[model samples]
Target: MRRLMSNNLILSLFSLKMFEIFGCIWRYIAFVSNQNTFLLLTILKNDFITKNFNYKISIKT
Candidate 1:
């Protein structure tokens, strides 16, 4: 039971991460066609935030 529970938890976490990645990719694609400086800046900001998030996760692990 414990093993199953852990597996399910891991699966859920993985799915959430996948969803976030897809969302970011979709946003980036949308931004690509925008051709606006502000939108590009916003995408860059998101990239910075993603880098920070990865750093925090690594530190926690």
Candidate 2:
């Protein structure tokens, strides 16, 4: 479970970075067409936060 959580954290961070890069590259599209990039970014941010929070909680216990 701990290893799985750590892997999830890594995947989340990797995905977040990818989205951030894509966000930078397609910022104009995001501004003009849709807010998908930001939405995905926020989702990833929440995922990372939750995973990190769980990791901390497990460590404490």
Candidate 3:
């Protein structure tokens, strides 16, 4: 029937919109996690450098 076909069309459109929204959210989460990991790596590197510098100073003294 025509009505059944129209209903199916609407449902497909709705599902497509939902899929698009989910894709955007997934990409955003991935981007934020990557930024967090980069920040953590930088913090660790700085800590290591400071510790090494302190160790060298103590050895010299």
Candidate 4:
């Protein structure tokens, strides 16, 4: 009975460690995706600004 309890304890500990590692990986993926989205937004914003500037210059000319 003691051996069974010890085995269960070890298994639980292992599962807990796995859960923590998976959590860290999930957080990292979320952070990276957020950064990618931010970059895409900035690129789109820059393109829009350039387009507007060009249009204004063309109208002036």
Q: Would you estimate the TM-scores of all the predictions?
A: 0.51, 0.45, 0.52, 0.52
Cα lDDT of model 1 by residue, 1-61, tens digit? 7886686667657756865886687677776666585577567767866875785466446
Clashes of each: 0, 0, 0, 0
What does candidate 3 score on TM?
Answer: 0.52
Model 4, 1-61: lDDT tens digits are 7886686667657756765665566566657788776566556655755765675466446
Give candidate 3's root-mean-square deviation (CA, Å).
Answer: 24.5
What residue runs in model 3 are displaced by over 4 Å at the alpha carbon? 34-61
Residue 38 of model 4 has an lDDT of 59
TM-score of 1: 0.51
lDDT of 2 by residue, 1-61 (tens): 9997797778668867865775565565557666777677667666766776686577557
Q: After aligning candidate 1 to the native by TM-score, how far in Å is the CA of 30 from where it should be?
A: 1.3
Q: Which pairs clash (backbone N, Cα, C closer than 3 Å) in model 2?
A: none
RMSD values, in order shown = 5.9, 6.3, 24.5, 24.4
At residue 42, what lDDT does model 4 achieve? Answer: 58
Candidate 3 lDDT, tens digit per residue, 1-61? 7886686667657756765665566566657788776566556655755765675466446
Can you give the lDDT of residue 30 in candidate 3?
57
